[model samples]
Target: MNQEIQEYNESQTTDIKDVCNRLAQIIDGNLPEAESKIWHRHPVWFLDGNPTVGYSIQKPGVRLMFWSGADFEENGLNVVGKKFKDASIFFQHVSEIHQEDLVRWLNKSKIIQWDYKNIVKRKGELVRLKKS
Candidate 1:
């Protein structure tokens, strides 16, 4: 994990901390090629500079978000973003994280991606960079 991301995980309360640590470990293990850092004040992993997966401490809980997950077609990633191609699921406890599901989502994240890296250049329009 990145230094700042480590601190971010450490800064969370106990339950949330466990969830963050577990999430970080799983993401690192699965997406070894992805770059991880604290983006928008949360831990986010990127593939080829495009944001892929990330998590943040939200009022609801720890939100695991996939930038292109709206098209992943998986029912578990049900919290879809209205303005972007993002999708998410909340986890208040580390136990809620199913390794198989997480790995599956991570795999899908690699194959399904939105061009958030150039959203500024495209003037808020999103383009698909990968597909299932």
Candidate 2:
């Protein structure tokens, strides 16, 4: 277990911590011995050396980010960055966490390969194509 994540969870309120714990558990349970790491001070779940999901304690609450969020059919998640395919979902309370949806997201996200720089380059190419 990463001490950074433990410390991060410990610093949060009970509700916020619960949401974090549940998200961690969901990812761990779904994946085959998932590897956990602290990236950018946030707890990240990885699959085959690729980042699948991550969670952090933001002022608004626990912010959950998924790497393959753009692959989803509906754009319900807030776009995390224009340069990457990641998306974010905010949870202020444990009760607000939708376990089923999260499970689905993690399951789907684990298989997608995300290359942030390449994605950004490709996006820029598409923009250039459109202007021309």
Candidate 3:
């Protein structure tokens, strides 16, 4: 993670760390060997260095962004922000997190990452990754 990104993330609410940690647990628990790092001022999960998931803390809620979520058939996942159009989902609370749905989405994201590594590799490029 770059110092500027870290500083920007740190500038958010105190729950930022907690949200990051919890989201990391969720990703790690469901997707074994998933790589994680700070990207675009948020915690990002990757497969083979390609981003699959991302998260950040906001004032009233946490946001989880899934890069390939919209491609899935299910619609139970929450959506927010203008960024939602490009295969992403957002969650305000952990309680709103559906493990099965998330796992499905994460699996799909993993495939997306594997399918087109270079196109989806950049940070803040708006490639889908879950945000919380």
Candidate closest to the true structure, highest TM-score:
1
Tens digits of per-residue lDDT for model 2, 56-123: 88788888888767655445578756665778889988888777887777766755546542445566
Per-residue lDDT tens digits for candidate 1, residues 24-102, read: 9999999999999998888999999999999999999999999899988989987545889888999999999999999
Cα lDDT of all candidates, in order? 0.92, 0.71, 0.60
Q: After superposition, how far is residue 4 of candidate 1 from its true place, in Å?
A: 1.2
Q: Which 10 successive residues of model 3 have the least lDDT summed?
A: 123-132
Ranking by lDDT: 1, 2, 3
After superposing candidate 2, which stretches have Cα over 4 Å from the reference? Answer: 1-3, 116-132
TM-score versus the correct structure, for each prediction = 0.95, 0.77, 0.61
Weakest 10 consecutive residues of candidate 1 by summed lDDT: 74-83
Number of the candidate with higher TM-score, 1 or 3: 1
| lDDT, candidate 3, at 31 | 71
Model 2: lDDT of residue 126: 20
* TM-score of model 3 vs. true structure: 0.61
